[model samples]
Target chain A: MSQCLHQVAGPVWNLGRLNHVAIAVPDLGKAAAFYKDVLGAQVSEAVPLPEHGVSVVFVDLGNTKVELLHPLGKDSPIAGFLQKNKAGGMHHICIEVDNIKAALMDLKNKRIRSLSDEAKIGAHGKPVVFLHPKDCGGVLVELEEA
Target chain B: MSQCLHQVAGPVWNLGRLNHVAIAVPDLGKAAAFYKDVLGAQVSEAVPLPEHGVSVVFVDLGNTKVELLHPLGKDSPIAGFLQKNKAGGMHHICIEVDNIKAALMDLKNKRIRSLSDEAKIGAHGKPVVFLHPKDCGGVLVELEEA
Candidate 1:
């Protein structure tokens, strides 16, 4: 088994709660239309993140949000993921917490690997860190401050 | 882009809402321990589905669930998924709806593909269908009726 256990999201890895799920899509307009028209999620904001080379659309899902990712530049992480996955799909699952730094330190000390090594500004400009799926059983997870 | 749009989720494609995200772990007890003690997720029940060759433990998150999958028989789909996805991880995302047949038909009309032609009894023995990720951008989705 891996040496690290990321229990910082609190006892059961529960910091606050799920914030949103990011899905990588080839077409932002089509994905937006599906969630908005069919599923009834309201579009809160759509922003082009040049730094990440992706355009993001936030679809409000009542208690939470669903982020749709479409590549803006060929070099974007989402774009890279699409190339590797060869099928646009889920990017990562995000969770909200009270304290991100504390959680990161805890995860680090416990030996759980992190993708970023430090918190970065995420959607809504919130501080977030992504934990390696190796320590988390397979699913890529992101922890952020609410 | 391809022509298919909605019908991927079975007949209804009317995925009412996000249902649950399934995670696979090497040790069910240890993993379930992490989610329950840390995440504050209440453990509902541990069910075994011989047909699927897996056992499941659900961690409730309001209306949704975090399904923990552990392979029962060596030939289980979960076992194959684990072999393909080392370190275990999020296996699939489930969506709930009002009607299963209608959802399936809806997806068919959209030309979206399905893993199962009809809804089969799932972990809770509820009617459910797994949608092929090829239809969606990349995420494997499950459609079900509540």
Candidate 2:
């Protein structure tokens, strides 16, 4: 199995397609409008993800999506980010994968850390897990089930 | 020409496929090794882009690319980013466009500001322009000719 390991190790597991690039914005409405009215992009209705502590809107890019996230509550996760950066910025990126559990197992086996203990339902309504930003060169990487 | 304007305004510019997501790294070799050895990603040989003041390597993700950028000179654009983020992080994303000039014109007409007056040859060997981060909700966006 070492040869199989070697081949898979050339590029282990499936690094699937990029699902979306998430951007955190101070004002969801204004950001969405900027893309829609100015850039002529199709902006989706804002959906509140209370569990995730953010309200999100998707700007359809035809090929991919630009997700706009805003803090939903006083203790929202994005509140700290907004506090540090008055203006919004790119938050995280989601990459599609075949199996969340398998991916997690593989990453753990490689000593890669996951932000959470287990997978959770993400904005796409799919099982997802976040990799530690430190482990991902400061970029928050999210793996979602395809 | 109002009808023509309307046609162009309906997402007139084509937002082609995402070319690559660039991540600024403190140590290019270490970052490349992390992706290659740990993540099992096939990492390309690092190439120095003297004009851009950085050394870069691409990690093929099958669907897209992850570009690792390391500062090569004192005035490298990514130097300041790394100074603030000692651990390094996602820098900017490059999206493919059909006509760089046309896309710039469209963005300019809509009041979107580009970081430069003209397109420059980017690491991908394509004409590219970076949009002002403030104008793009704080995300530095690179538009490259398809």
* Best prediction by lDDT: 2
TM-scores for every predicted model:
0.80, 0.86
Model 2 segments more than 4 A misplaced: A1-13, B1-12
Candidate 2, residue B139: the lDDT equals: 81
Per-prediction RMSD in angstroms?
5.3, 4.0
TM-score per model (chain B):
0.84, 0.91
lDDT of 2 by residue, B107-144 (tens): 88767899998999987788999999888787888989
lDDT of 1 by residue, B3-119 (tens): 354434244333466767788787788777766654445875668878888888887666466789999976888887788766777777777777888867766665667898999
Task: Please state what fraction of the native interface contacts candidate 1 reproduces.
Answer: 0.42
In model 1, the runs with Cα more than 4 Å from the true position are: A1-14, A33-46, B1-14, B36-46
Give me the TM-scores for chain A across all models, comma-separated.
0.83, 0.89
lDDT string for model 1 (A1-146, tens) is 23344442333333676677788887778777766654445774569888767899997655566688988866776777777766677778787777778777666666678899789997568898888876666667888888
Best by TM-score: 2
